[model samples]
Target chain A: MKRNKKMIIAFITPALVTFLVMFVYPVIRTVIMSFFKVESLTASTSEWQFAGLDNYIGIWKTPIFRTSMINMGVIWLVGGVIVLSVSLLLAVILTSGVRFKSFFRAAIYLPNVISAVALAIMWIQYVFSKKYGMLTSFFRALGLDNLAKISWLDSDMKFWAMLIAFCFGAVGYYMLIFLSGIEQIPQDLFEAATIDGANKMGQFAHITLPLLKGVFKTNLTFWSINTMMFFVWSKMFSPVETEASTISPVVYMYNIVFGTKGVTQRDAGRGAAIGVTMALFVLIIFFIFNRVLKDDDLEY
Target chain B: MKKKVISAVLCTTMAVAMLAGCGSNGGAKSNSTSKATSAASSAAESTSAKSKSTEPAKAEGGKNLVYWSMWNETEPQAEVIKDAIEEYQTESGNTVTVEWKGRDISTIIQAALDAGETIDLFDEDYQRVGQQYASKCMDLEDMAKAADYETHSVEALPTALRGWAGSLKGIAYQPYTSGIFYNKAMFKEAGIEKEPATWTEFLDACKKLKDAGYAPLVQDDAYVLYSYGFQIARHLGQDGVVDLCKNGGWAESEGALAAAKEIQSLVESGYYSEYAPDAYPNNENEIGYENAAMIVNASWVPSEITNNTKCDIEWGMFNYPTVDGGKDPATVANVGAQAFAIPDNSKNGQAAFDLIMKITTGAFDQKMALDTQSIPADPTNEEWPEMIAGCKDAFNALTNVYDWNMGLNTDADLKTVIQDNLMKLFEGKMTAEEFIAAVDAASK
Candidate 1:
């Protein structure tokens, strides 16, 4: 027993030290700095104190923060559902004893290997350009040049366009995850279903999906987290002076803390308040989501 | 009793060791090399300079810096900066390790800023300058007033550039200047004789090009739209309007409204080539594939848009298409210079500052043009591509500053209002009048 205790201590020490130094220290520092107003960049060195929960209360009243929360939640739902559903469907289709399965698998998984910046550029340049985009050129070749030069990222369809690019780039990884889950299923169950005269569709609905519940839960949870971290993508995607779309909770927190291109005093307390609020909200959201989505346990 | 004894002993040893570690060693030849460079650069500026910035790094010696850049718009210039650093390291063996944050300074830059932490040196966006001033996050005056002040000559920067950096509160880097970049071949194909000198002719030319199966313009809607609106605002508010807009909500009221109307008309008229919203192009694209004959972009686009893409573009530039009877023909040509600042908490401040001064103010300009093929800051460089340098007068005629609110001017509520309601206008969810009302409501 004593030896086990020592072993556990040895294993846990590094992580514990890391958490205290990296995570705990920063959080405490940020929470404390969330108060006090910046006079000028170099003039202040003092760690300013709190002026009540003004930082926390103030963020709630700001429309930007509110909109970000709404948009982040929506992106989580929409991006998660679309990527998961489509990729899972593709994984199953390729795995259903089909010809050229390996080729199809490689093609499906190709995009995830490419960097997001590179993928984003390719989508803009060769794929969507009304002039040179293969898509636009095909239309022009058919003499429907009016459709050429259409701006995909304009206000009319900017969000959808961004969503499409993000989903398309991300589907490959999700497909592989779903494929692994599909592979782990017992072949005997499908055979049993066949003997009972259940069609392919019936076998899929009755056995495949129900049995893949654990994977789906894991996939959706991760997807939600990824979508929620949208700041960098949103800023990159927006035109100057226009608003950003990928402003996740993290982005909003960042903007509040560091300030933005052309506005406001640094409110560290408010930024911390936003961070605290987000963490708590994320927890609440996960709880509500699991409660709503959790079905009966599926035996292996 | 045993746990207490161990804890007490470990804490004392570790704490003492950490304190010692933070204090960098002074006994190195590399430190002497850095000191020598600082001395040589100082001698170049003046003989009688008394700035104490000549001192070696004081906070802690031989500090490690984690620097990130968004994305370097030009690969050649990126190469030049990289080579220069490598050269510096070879010459002095004092290295500041770099990590690219992103292509456009948005990725790691945003993360760093949001983290509310001190960074050693970074290519921060010009827009962040205003916020830094307001939030007291940056110190331009201090950055410009360093010890070797004479040699680096930061104080000698163009007033217009300095003013744009939000100099009063924080130090904002001077940004790229916006100009009109057009396809020369497209002009000939449309049978237009010369660059438009008046707004009527500009629109007529665009209309003709539209009819000739070419997009007259393309909207990136990703980075330059609101800036485009700011440029247009200069034209709409003629006759001392720049001053008027800065002093009051006259810009947001009448100025932003007019610009909004112009954007709507552009959308309705079908003169634009659109890219996807998420696209941040650091390289060649189909637009330069001769899609739209022209684009309104900053100084760096010359490097970013050419050489890589296989477009045989014969490019030419014009001033902001002449505004009607405008007092000043100059519309705002955005100047977004990313400034490198030393954080108050940085231990490597002196070394980083010395390096920054050497890199930005010296061979970096020539290196930039040669490496990236972009326009050079130093006018003396003969290597500049004719397309960019030949029409210098026309380009210089464009305004260089944003010329809006500063000094307690906060963009928080204003930016929020615009982001929310502006989308509706772009999405066909709101009209020009509605946008006007939205601005008015926001201002009040």
Candidate 2:
């Protein structure tokens, strides 16, 4: 037992050290920093003193702060459901001995290989172009001359349509993750269900889904974290400057420090505060989700 | 015990990583300075004292020189700098490496100053760093005081050029000029006789184009909105946005609001679309050239816009139409390109300034203009490209130049107040009275 404990400590030490440095230290600094008024980052003689909860209040009072939460929520629910449903459907279809199963999986995972910036450029210039865009000319070739000038960006249904585009580009990769998870279930389970006179639908609901609960939970946590950070894309090309468009709270923090040409390049203290808040939000969501779902973890 | 030990380790790691950033940048600075000091005592001792050109001058005892500019020193303009870099290298056996950071020179300079980062030379487009001039970033007067200063600093460029550097706070690296452009083919098809000179003529021509099913003025709301203060100077009757900045006022005068109303008319006229001001960088405006008749763009606009769009449309620039009372009725100067000072902590000021002149006035100007259609900053380049060279007549007329948002000293507390609410003027969110009050409210 003593030897085993030593082995465990040795194995965990590297990861523990990395986590402390990468995650916990920032949170500690942020908690300490949340107590002060920010000044220019380079004030030599000036000091960052304690100010206790003021930064928190300042963030809470800002209208954009609340709106960011709503936007995150929207991305969460929408991305989660669509991702789950499509991924499960693909998983089911793939398990049925599809002719080009390997090829299909690779094709869907293509988006994962492309960089975000390249994907953004491809979508903006070729896919969603407004006046004289590539999509327009394509439509015109098909006899819809006026459609060549159609701008999806300026339409009243902007967010709705953009949501669909996001889903299409993103679903394939996550679906592959589900496909791998789905493939792991034993063949005997399905055979047993069929022998028991359970129809395909009944087997899918009773056996397939229950056994796949672990995979679903894993993907849920995985995607929730992914969607939470979707602001990375939102800041790059959304049309409006609403909290939904130009900034997420983290990106907003970036602008606060780096955007202006002033003496304050970045406020380390305030950045820490923002980081802590973000971590807290993510943790809260994780707990709330776990509590609501009871996170059924099953063993074979 | 596991949690405690884990927490301690986590805290230590976090402290180190964050400090790692502080360490790299800060350590670099200290390491350079100490090396520079050691070099200052003996030329032989200094060459190997530092590893990079982080110290102010004398990296390997002048084996290297660094020039930092707000943007890339690219072709059509970088040639002179490249030649000068060669000359500089041959003369001293020192290679001048140019750091071409695009945009955000102001913040870079400030950070350098704070860190005492040695910069050799720094310059940026005036509009981007104009706000820096409103505060003290660096002083040209002091540069003139430097022992290595040249005869070029003695006489200075032309007054307008000098003004480019002279908010009395920061110095301009070079002077820039502006002009107007129109589609020559569009005018001929519309059969509107000539380019408009007066406001009525301008409006009339616009109406005719509108009637002809063309957007009269293709103002890009996606880019920073371009409105010339000089042409409207005749109407404002005051010193324009400048005088207002000095005395803490915004002109509610008949002229200023009239300009706003004119723009509002264009917006309300269903002839306009804008990317959200902050968000337009990637939006539909990149595809702007195919739809609109005329654009209020500087010389660089043609290449930048047409780079992606291969439209073979004939375009031309003319003087911005003016009211009878405006200063220099043909003037269109509000924002134009100019270089700005580097932070005082520059390590290689000589090499940087040497590069600036080469890029701006030297042979690079000719090469850049010919290749890229970028207008020359020298104001005397007669060997011109046909389309761009022809712009001199229009370029010379710019005066009464002012943009509240363009200068370095923009009152920041009021910037959002002005920009957010002022955009509403284009959105027709306020009356002219409200517009003036809204913008002015920021300064106060």
Which candidate tops lDDT?
1
**Clashes per candidate, residues 3 or more apart or on different chains:** 33, 27
lDDT of each: 0.58, 0.54
Candidate 1 lDDT by residue in tens digits, B41-149: 5443443333354332232223455444444424454455565555444333355556554444543343445455556666655455443422423444554465444
The digit string of per-residue lDDT tens for model 2 on B1-444 reads 796588667756865665575453321111112233344345534443221211123333344545555554554344444554554444333455566665545456555656666555556545444443323354545433342233322122224334544542333433434445666777777778887778778777777776777666643223322342333344553255445545565655555566666666666765443432223433223333444566555565555555556655555667667775654455645444555455555555544444444454435555645665766554445565655554566665555554423331233333333434445554455665777776666455
Q: Model 1: how far is A103 from its true place, Å? A: 4.6
TM-scores for all predictions: 0.72, 0.72
Docking class of 2: incorrect
User: Lowest summed-lDDT stretch of 10 residues in model 1 chain A?
Assistant: A36-45
Question: Which 10 consecutive residues of model 2 chain A have the lowest summed lDDT?
Answer: A238-247
CA RMSD per model (angstroms): 7.2, 8.0
The total of clashing pairs for model 2 equals 27
TM-score result, candidate 1: 0.72
